[model samples]
Every structure is written in structure tokens, then in C-alpha cells.
Target: MKAKARAHANIALIKYWGKSDENLSLPMNSSLSLTLDAFYTETEVEFTNSINEDVFFLNGVEDKNTLSKISKFLDLFRIARNMNERAIIKTINYVPTAAGLASSASGFAALAAATNKASGLDVNSRELSTFARRGSGSATRSIYGGIVEWQKGINDKTSFAVEIDDASWDIGMVVVIVNREEKKMSSREGMKSTILTSPFYKNWPEDSQKDLKEIKIAIKEKDFEKMGYITERNALKMHATMLGANPPIMYFEPKSILVMQIVHELRDKGIPCFFTMDAGPNVKILCRLSQGEMIKNRLMEDFKEYEIIVTGPGPGVEII
Candidate 1:
């Protein structure tokens, strides 16, 4: 059986900082994200009777470390379908890898879609989200299009994402890719370290929940300024927890700080933009679609070395 699928990467508006059950990929706080059109992953899966083990290829090159993770991910589908066949999976990523771009979210969502199709599982989107969550926690949100809210369920059955808004309004994201190399600390390691050592970590979930509620209201009102304000503050609060850790973990570089200041300058000039960063040095700015080019042009003046991509909301995973 062979199946091919595509899924887009998502940026967390209200971040999912820590996990309650790491093994199951369950998060401590419910998260919300905007799936962007600029970054995505396409995957093809073939389940064959001849192969003895699962194999993975990324951008035409075989990756053993990635294969190990995918193999385990495939087991969920295998166990459900009662299939012993091995799979050959090839993934092509449009987004830069390991640059805080949510590549794994799209990667695993695509894998879950392709593998489920190959195994003859015709599940609903919620079930699909649950399946994807087992691979990467953010993958749950990647299963839906536009603005999605991932409810942090107490267990596997209840944990899934739902679309909050179509995001057809005049809103978009400008991604500033400062570094392409992998980060020193992985999201998982950074999250666990912060959770265990940072006293500030205790209030993160509560603050994130409040942001989630307020942001939802802002989205319903279609108030871009309100949404941007809350998103920026929420992202800053997430990074604050990392700094409070015993052995402080910081994600922002010099360029990241500069970009943040530029966003503030733009806001002061009445451009109405806000910046958010994940577990990396890259910065993403949320602004009105009409102001996208202006923001891009302004960013180009100072950061000539970085890559800036402007994109709007994207659709959910689909079989192709």
C-alpha cells in the first residue's frame, strides 16, 4: 500500500511550554496556533511485505536517527491495524529544519496522514489529530487549518485540536529565519529542564490559559491589534520561564533582540505588528496582510543576511 500526504507547519500563539506526560506527548497547557502556508512537509509512505523494518528518508537522504523515531511512531498505526509490514517513508520539507520553525509538527502530521492511509485507516480529523499528537504534540494542531486550538486532554482519547477560526481576515505572519543549524538544546530537553528547575514554570500554564481565553475572544472580534498584543506578551512570558531555570536556558540571540526592537519601532510608527519566538533565535511577526510587504521591506534594511518569508494561514493535512 502506498499513500502520499502534505501538512503545514504551525506557530504557537499561546505556547505549549511543558508536557504532563512526555511519553504520550501530552501537554500541560492547551495551545493555539496558526498554520502558515510558507512552511510545510510532504511525505510518501509505502508499506511492503518484503521489508523487515521501517526506513526513513529526508530530502532524498537516509536518516537513521529520524528513522528510529518514525518507526516507533508507525507502531501506533501498526498496532491498531494489526499489520506487520514495514514502511519506506520519504519526506520533503519546504521549511528549514531545526530552526524553531515547527518542522516536526508538519513532519509528523504528514507521516501520520500517509501512514494511516497506507494502513487503510479512515479516521476522522479528531482521531487523526490524536494519532498525530502521539508523534509530536504540536502535530495535533497541524492537523487543522488556519487558527486551531489544541485542548490538553487528560489522556490520549480526549487530546485533540479543533479549528477556532478560518483566519480569512486580513492577517498574516512574516517569518525571519536567522539560523538554519540545529539548536543546542532540543525543545523536549529545554522544556523538561525548565519544568524541573524553574520556579516560574509553576505559573506558565495558568498564564497561558488566560492568554488562550483572551486571544480566542480577540479572534472572534477580529481585532488584530488585541490579538497581536496578547500573543507577544504570552510569548515573552514563555521565554521568561527558561531564564528562571537553575542553569538558565536562553533562545534569543543578538539578532533576535534587534528584530524585536524593530517590531516595536514598527508598532510605534503605527504599523501594528507583534513578534513571537519559539525555542530558537528566529522571530515571527504577526501583522495585517496589507502591511506585510512594508514590514518585510523594513526588515530587509537592517538584516540583509537573514531570510524573511511572508505567509498567511494554510489548510489542514490532505492526501494527494
Candidate 2:
């Protein structure tokens, strides 16, 4: 059997920084994200009786570390289907791998879709989200298009994501890629470090819950300013908790601050926009599609070396 799938990367507006159950990949708080068309992953899977073990490839390279993780995920699918045959998986990414972009979100979403179809499993998006979460927590949201929200459920079966809106109101994002290097501290390590050491992290879940509520309301009303404001604030709060860690974890480079200042400057001049950063130096500016070109042109002046990607809402996982 053979199957192929593609899924888009999602940027969290209300971030999920910690987890209550790390083994199940359950989040400590709910998160909301916007799936973007600029970055995605496509995966193909083939299962046969001839293969001795599972094989994984990324961008035409056989990656052992990535292979191990994919193999573990495939084990879950095999256990559910009660099939012992191994599969060969090949994945190609359109986004940067580990530089704070949601590459894992799209990567595993595409994997889950591909594996499920190739193995002849019949499951809905909700079940697919749960499977994807076992690979990456944010991947649960990536299983849906537009604005999706992941409910921090009490258990594995309960945690899933749903589409909040089609995001059809001319909304878009400009991805500012500052550093393409792999993050020094993996998200798993960073989250554990912050949870154990940062006093500010104690209240992050409560604050993020409030943010998720407000953002959903803003999306319902199609109020870009309200959505952007909450998103920016939520991202800052997430980073603040990291900074309060014992070693004062820092992810923003000097250029990251430069880009953020530019966004603030544009906002003051009556352009409705806001900036958000994840676990890396890159900053994502959420703005209206009408102003996307203006925002890009303005940033290009200072960030000629950095790659700026402008994209609108993307679709959910699809079989190709």
C-alpha cells in the first residue's frame, strides 16, 4: 500500500509552553494557531511485506535521529492496526526545520495522514489530531486549516483541535526568518527547564487560557486589531516565562528585536499589525492581506539578508 499527504505549518497565537503529561504530549494549557500556506510538509509512505524494518528519509537524506522518532510514531499506528509490516517513509519540508518555525507540526501531521491511509486505517480528523499530537503537541492544531484551537483535555482521548474560523477576512502573516540554525535548546528541554525553574511559568496556563478566550471572540467578530493585540501580548508572556528561568533562557537575537521594533513603528503609523516570536529568533508579523506588501517592503530595507515570507490561511491535511 502507498499513500501521500501534505499539511501546512501553524503559528501559535496563544502558545502552549508546558505539558502536564509529557508522555502523551498533552498540553498544560489550550493553544490557538493560524495555519499558513507559505510553509508545509509533504510525506509519502509505502508498506510492503518485503521490508525488514521501517526506514525514514528527509529531503533525500537518511536521518537517524529523525528516523528513530518516526519509527516510534509508526509503532503506534501498527499497534492500533495490529499490522507488523514495516513501512518506508520519505518526507520533504518547505519550511526551516528547527528554527522555531512549526516544522514538526506540519511534519507529523503529514506523517499521520500518510501512515493512516497507507495502512488502511479509517479515522476522522479528531482521531488524526490525537495521533499527530503524540509526535508533536502543536501538530494537533495543524490537522485543521485556518484558525484552529487545541483544547487541553484531561486525557489523551479528549485533547483534539477544531477549526475556529475559515480565516477568510483578508488575514495574513509575514514570516521573518532570522536564523536557520537548529535551536540550541530543544523545545522539550526548554519547556522542562522553564517549568522546573521559572516562577513566572506557574501562571502561564491561566493567562494563556484568558488569551485563548479573547482571541476566539475577536476572530468571531473579524476584528484584526483585537486579534493582533492579544496574539502579540500572549507571545511576549510566553517568552517572559522562559526568561525567568534559572539561567535566563534567551531565544531572541539582536536582529529579532530589530524586527519587533519595526513592527511597532508600523503600528504607530496606522498600519494594523503585531509581532509574535516562538522559541527562536524569527518573528512573525500578523497583518491584513491589504497591507502585506507594504509591511514586507518596509522590512526588506533593514532585513535584506533575512528571508521574508508572506502567506495567507492554508488548508488542512490532504491525500495526494
TM-score of each: 0.98, 0.98
The residue ranges of model 2 lying beyond 4 angstroms of the native Cα positions read 96-98
Residue-level lDDT tens digits of model 1 in 1-320: 99999999999999999999998899999999999988999999999998898889999999898788899999999899998999999999998555789999999999999998999987888899999999999999999999999999999989999999989998899988887878889899999999999999999999899999999999999999999999999999999999999899999998899999999999999999999999999999998877898899999998888788889999999999
Q: State the lDDT of candidate 2 residue by residue for 37-131, as single tens digits.
A: 98899999998889898888989898778778898998888999999899889999998545889999999999999998998885899999999
lDDT of 2 at 68: 80
Single out the weakest 10-residue window by summed lDDT for candidate 2: 94-103
Off by over 4 Å in 1: none
CA error at residue 292 for candidate 2, angstroms:
1.1
* Residue 68 shift from truth in candidate 1, angstroms: 1.2
- Pairs in steric clash, model 2: none
